[model samples]
Each structure stands twice: as structure tokens, then as C-alpha cells.
Target: MPTGPTIIGFDADDTLWHNEPFFRMTQERFAELLRDHADPDHLMERLLEAERRNLGHYGFGIKGFVLTMIETAIEVTDGRVPASTISHLLNEGREMLRHPVDLLPGAEDTVRQLSQTHVLIMITKGDLLDQERKLAESGLGDLFDGVEIVSDKKAATYTRAFADHGDGAQAGLMVGNSMKSDVIPAIEAGAWGVFCPSEQEWALERADPPVAAPRYHEIASLHELPDLVKTL
Candidate 1:
């Protein structure tokens, strides 16, 4: 194994920029739109359930999320949801897709610093077009050796990403906010997994860390990453 990770992967959404907040804001608006049909809390619960249930069919991203919201609205209203309400939900999804890419604190500098010594790659899961747009807008695109806009983050996916870009498995390091998508799977694939918690986490992506994993690490922020990587 290498003395340290030769390839570093980053999760793009909440990890690189402000992402979940947009989704949360949209959900709040959604709850208000359907307040007449159900309590906001109940509506949110239903919407979350819908998103979770539809994950397999729709995969992940704003497009899938919008579809689930439409389904939830119809389900909550017993198929009586107004056409205007549906239109509004679709508009909301468009707005989310158009939302600006706001980089997280220290993300750019840290990545730039790490890129000097190690290969840096972005491994994000979402709609490809939207993700590509964000990367284009982020101004950090040139910093990466490669970018992997994946449907999901699994051990196999991590393994492949590493094999293609790095020395493979033990020579890779994955960093992101979601423990489920960024940390565990990478660690399971024999790479180091570093968790940098985000301000807002999507319910579906939440999970407890593998505390006993020797390569699993949790940091307070991306600001701490360069030093950590140096020490590793």
C-alpha cells in the first residue's frame, strides 16, 4: 500500500457546495402548497417516504425528487391534487436545477492544495446534466484529474473509480458529507474514507459511521483536510 492516498475523491453536492438547503427550501415551499390537504409535517413525511420508495426507479437528483413530490401530492390529496399545484411543483424543480452553485468554505483551497501532491477526482451522484452544469459553474472544474457523476456510491463504484484514476483500492481516499455515500463504501472498498459533515443532510443519505474501521475519519470541516492528508 502507498504511504498515503494517491487519489482523493470528493462528493460534489453538499460536500462541495450548498445543496441540501435548496432541497429543504423547496420542500418547505412544497409543504405550504399542500397545507390545505395535509399538515406540513405529515406532508413532509409523506414526501420523504415517496422519495425513498421511488429511489430505485428514479435513481437520484432533482428530477427524481420532483417526480416523488408530484406522487406524494397526489397520494396525500387522494388523487385530487389540482393541476395548478402540479405545475407549481414542476416550476419549483426547475428553480432548483437553476440554483447557483455556492462552494462550501475551504473546499477550493483545500482541493487545490491537495491536487499538488495527489490526484483529485470528484465522485458525485445525481442527474448528469445538472451535475455537469454545477461543475461548470463552480470554477473548480480544472482542479480535478477526473470527474465521476455516478447514480449511487457503492464499494464497487469506489473500486472502479480508484482503479481508473488512482493506484486503486488502498491507494484511494474518499471525502464528503454523507457517511452512507462517501465514507463507508470507500472504506469498505479498502480506501480511506474521510467524513466532513455538512450543515444539512438529506434523510435518505444519513447513516452512522463505521467507528471501528481503521481507515475511517471524521473531520470538522474541509479546512482541516490538507493537514490531515499531509499527516496521513
Candidate 2:
């Protein structure tokens, strides 16, 4: 018999650990390197646009980002960029690979406590290899009974995930940083959605507010979740 929520889905990137900060850092460096010729904000906008367009093709993660940077460099520079720019991009890619993996303040412990009561699932969208490595390194891999690495998070993604976990839409809750990808979609699929806002934003386009949000709740920290679940 299910005691708490039957299924709990978590977003892995910024929700689980530090993700966007690294991207922002890399972007800033990219801008500084190209500041002599181009506007940083415009360059960032272009890069983000490219990433959005390529979401289906490359998915999310450092590798896709690196590729986008390379492509953006080529496009913006019209192949006039020197070898040093290419080398800098390559070095940044390597740095992304080497960045330390640190779990969010309450992520590990919160997951541990929740795992004991509910069926925990990690439903993240990103590059396959990097996500796998992060999960393995985060030391929370075994805590989740199910792990899903998806290319995108939408209504379809959540619907498939809920079905796959045998939750069948009932007693399902999604916890994550994005209101667009995680909260709205999961709630639309007949699951409860808990939005935990992060400092970083995921997409260039924001998700429209749900027409009906009876099952949606937003919390500040993961530590507050277990208790909230008990009340729901």
C-alpha cells in the first residue's frame, strides 16, 4: 500500500546540483574573449537561440553547449577568428569536464529521507554521458529506484515517466527548478508538481501558466518537501 506520494520525479540539473552557474561562467568568459568585436549580450542571445533551436538535435549538457559555442564562433566571426579562440573554446570544454560535482545543500539528505517512504525517480533532461556521470558522482545514484535521462521535459516526457514507473498519473509529484518543463507539464499529465525556483533559467521561452493548477505547489527548499508531501 502506498503511504506517501506513489511516485516522486526529480529534475537533475540545477535542482540537484550547481549547473547554470557553470554555464553562466563559461558564457561570460566567451563574451570577454569576443568583446573586441561583438556585443556580449547579443552574442549570448544568439548562443541561447542556437541552443533552443538545437534542443532536439543535441539535447542539453556541456557537449551540446560546446558545440553551439563553436558553431556560434564560426558563424559570428565568418571564419575570421584566430586559432587562439578555438583553443580557448576547447579549454573551456575541458574545464566543463573537470568542474567539481557538488550536491545542493539539502539534496542528498532530502532524497535519502524521501526515498525511504516514496518511490523516488530522477527524471532529468540532458546529454546522456554527462548526466550519467553526475548521477554516479553525486553519490545518490542508488537511492533512486528509477533513473530516466530524457532529451526533453514536456507533457509527453512526464506522461511516459509516470506510466513507466507504474504510477499511472495518480499519486505522482514532480520536483524541480523549471516551471515550464517540470511543474506545468507534470501537473498537466495529472501529477502533482512542486516548483522549486532556481537562480538560473532553462529555456529562452517561458511556459504559459496552467489553466488549472489545483495540484501545483511551490517550495523554496527540498528540506520542506517531505513534510509538504505528508500533508498532501
Candidate 3:
């Protein structure tokens, strides 16, 4: 464990549990709901645009996504969208909120094992209430030394989090699916950044890997994390 991190941070959503796929499913339903108004590909583009525009206003989470869907629906249909369609979208959002948390393969075991030697923290960005619910449902809440639910992930954010919770950013490592929100910024903040790519990543979270960084690492699954901690 020589030169190992003093703290390890994990991202929620698609990192530890199934998330993007629910959004994907809901979006597919949305496209079907408005199929008469626009083609599926074009509708997806409009929805993506709406999400980009609305991120600052609504932030990230199911709530923001659902709102963006409604906004996109209105824009694409020129405000002629039926009230019933809107109602159906609302129900879809509610269903997503109520969806059971499904932990990713090896997620629970990874966290449980790492929590033994390192000060483990869950640093994620999303709706506060919804995130809290997922963590509670995840049954791994007690394993974490800390949990940070922030509006966004940035270099300053990781610096503050690791400083407050452990030795500092220099002794921290963040593992997650997003190169943008999880890996790049954490490395920029002076912590090790481990990228564990997810199956259903959102486009906004995609970014080029920090291939030349000394502290950057990539693993195909959470199953590889413990050995990573040992080596680092």
C-alpha cells in the first residue's frame, strides 16, 4: 500500500448504478410519443439541444431531464403538442424517479473492499433528494466515509472535497464513468483520476482521456479497482 491514496471518491449514477439507460428508455418513449411530429433522429437532436440549453437553469438530474423533455416537445411541435402527451411525459418522469436502484456489476464489492483501507467518499452531481434516495437504497451508504452531492464537478470542487474529507487532493483518487466530470477535473485538482467507462454514457459527459497525465488510469470495470489501489 506504499504511495497509495489516503482517500478514494466514487461517482454515482452510471458509475455505481444503472442510470443513463433509464434516461435512454424514457427518451425512446418520448420519441415514440411525438413520432407523428418529427422523426426519431431529429427528435433526439432537438432533445439534446434542449438539455444543453437547460443545464444551467435546471442543473443535472431526472427533474432537469424531464423538464427538458417537456420543453423540447413544445418546441418541436410548435406548441401544438397535446396536453395528454405532456401528461404522459410527466408520468414517465415519475416512473424514472421511482425506478429501483440497480448496482453495476462489482460496484458493491469494489466499494466494500476499498472502504477497508482508504477513506472512501461518494462524490457525485445530481438532484440532492434523488441522489440521497439512491444511496440509501444502494445499501452501501454505511461503507462510505463521506458523501458529496454537488451541483457540478470541477477542479476546485474536488480540491475542496478531498481537503475537507482527507489529507488533500494530492492524496485522493476519483473513479467514475465520465472523463469530463470525474477523471479530467480530479487530475487537474492534483488527485489521481481513474476512468471506468460505462455502457450508457451521456454525450455531455464524454471527453478525451488524459492519456499523458502521470496520475491518470483506466479500468474496464470496478472489479479492477482494489488492485489499482494497491499499486497506486
Q: Residues 1-232, candidate 1, lDDT per residue (tens digit)?
A: 4598899999999888999999999999999999899999888888888888999999999999999999999999999999999999999999999999999999899988998999999999999999999999999999999999998999999999999997998899999999999999999999999999998888888999999999999999999999888877
Between candidates 2 and 3, the lDDT winner: 3
User: What clash pairs does model 1 have?
Assistant: none
Ranking by lDDT: 3, 1, 2
lDDT of 1 at 45: 88
Let me know the TM-score candidate 1 reaches against the reference structure: 0.98
lDDT, candidate 2, at 166: 55
Total clashes in model 1, counting residue pairs 3 or more apart in sequence or in different chains: 0
Superposed by TM-score, candidate 1 places the C-alpha of residue 52 at a distance from the truth, in angstroms, of 0.9
Tens-digit lDDT track of model 3 for 91-181: 9999999999999999999998888888999999999999999999999999999999999999999999999999999999999999999
- Report the number of the highest-lDDT candidate: 3
Off by over 4 Å in 1: none
Model 3: clashing residue pairs?
Answer: none
Candidate 1 lDDT (Cα, 0 to 1): 0.93
RMSD, model 1, all Cα superposed? 0.8
Each prediction's RMSD to truth: 0.8, 1.8, 1.0
- Reference-based lDDT, each prediction: 0.93, 0.84, 0.95
